[model samples]
Target: MTHVVGESCIGCKYTDCVAVCPVECFHEGPNFLVIDPEVCIDCGVCVAECPVEAVYDEKMLPAEQGEYVELNARLAKQWPLIVQSTEPLPEADTWAEKQDKREHLMEMS
Candidate 1:
């Protein structure tokens, strides 16, 4: 199964996961990142690089964060990836603070 990026990563735009992905499945969203399941090699590199521990295998995804499995697949179908960010980004504080916002920020990225 491919890796899925979850809620803990909702607003934390850390690019570490993007850098390590061999297939470039990590795509940036407005508030988080999405993984393209079709392209993911299932190598788990992105999961290891994620600072928030937000990346997980689709089969290993937590029950509460299950939506991310679909989210990752959908976005990967669209954006696919961002190839050039030169650094490990700090946590996106604004996104983290919006605990109640209901908009699908990942889709808008």
Candidate 2:
């Protein structure tokens, strides 16, 4: 199973998870990141690396965040690959505490 990046990552866009991904499955977007389900090795290392707990195994994804499974797959194709850790958004700390930020998700890198 692949790990999914959920709405919690919408504004925060932390790259901690990306650095730990051995398969370079993570994709970079303007305000978020997504896992390429087809490339993910399902190692689970990236899950704990996410400070906002945004990454989850597909099967363990919350019911309410179920859409992220497909979202991750779709977005991964459009976004650029991110294999290194980088600074998060300017308001990452503030955004990390907020929930339901799906509406803030940006589609561009």
Candidate 3:
């Protein structure tokens, strides 16, 4: 199983999870981060590191957020790798607790 970055990470884009990933599976986008399923070790370290609770194991993902599994996998290959923690997007705190953020997800880094 691999960890998926879901809708909650859309506009928030917190990098805390990236900081703890041992396998460097994280990829950075304009307003989100994704996990490269092929590289993820499934260690679950990123789940707790996400302040917005955006990361989840494949089996643990909410039914409504199921699309994120493929989203993360697809986007990871298109975005650049993120091996270190970095400042979140401006107003990240304001968006962190907001729900239904899938529409806000950006496609570019």
Candidate 4:
């Protein structure tokens, strides 16, 4: 398993997490940031760097936020290849509170 980003990261789009990620697995989402499961090393660096506390490990994530495991994995597969960075900020603002009304997904996972 790996770490995941949730609701707290929505419109926040801060790049603090990206700066600490050694693998640079985080990517710029239309609104928020997403982790690349395919490359994430499960180091948990991004977790501590997150200002809003939006990052969580797979095992620590709450039951309600579990779906984020699949969401990040699936989306990462679809995202185009990007140059990994030590700290990259999100580009757009597709986030709005609960963009998809699945705000619970932000609680832990």
How big is the positional error of residue 108 in model 4, measured in Å on the Cα after superposition? 23
Which stretches of candidate 4 lie above 4 Å from their native place?
80-109
User: What overall lDDT goes with each candidate model?
Assistant: 0.72, 0.92, 0.91, 0.67
Clashes of each: 1, 0, 0, 2
RMSD of 2: 0.7
- The digit string of per-residue lDDT tens for model 1 on 1-109 reads 8888887776667788777766676777666778888788899877787767878988999787787788778777776467655443355655555553335465653
What candidate 3 gets wrong by more than 4 Å, as runs, is: none
Model 3 residue 96 lDDT score: 83
Query: By summed lDDT, which 10 consecutive residues of candidate 2 come out lowest?
Result: 100-109
Cα error, candidate 2, residue 81 (Å): 0.4
Pairs that collide, model 1: 30-109
TM-score of every candidate relative to the true structure: 0.79, 0.97, 0.97, 0.71
The alpha-carbon root-mean-square deviation between model 1 and the true structure, to one decimal in Å, is 2.8
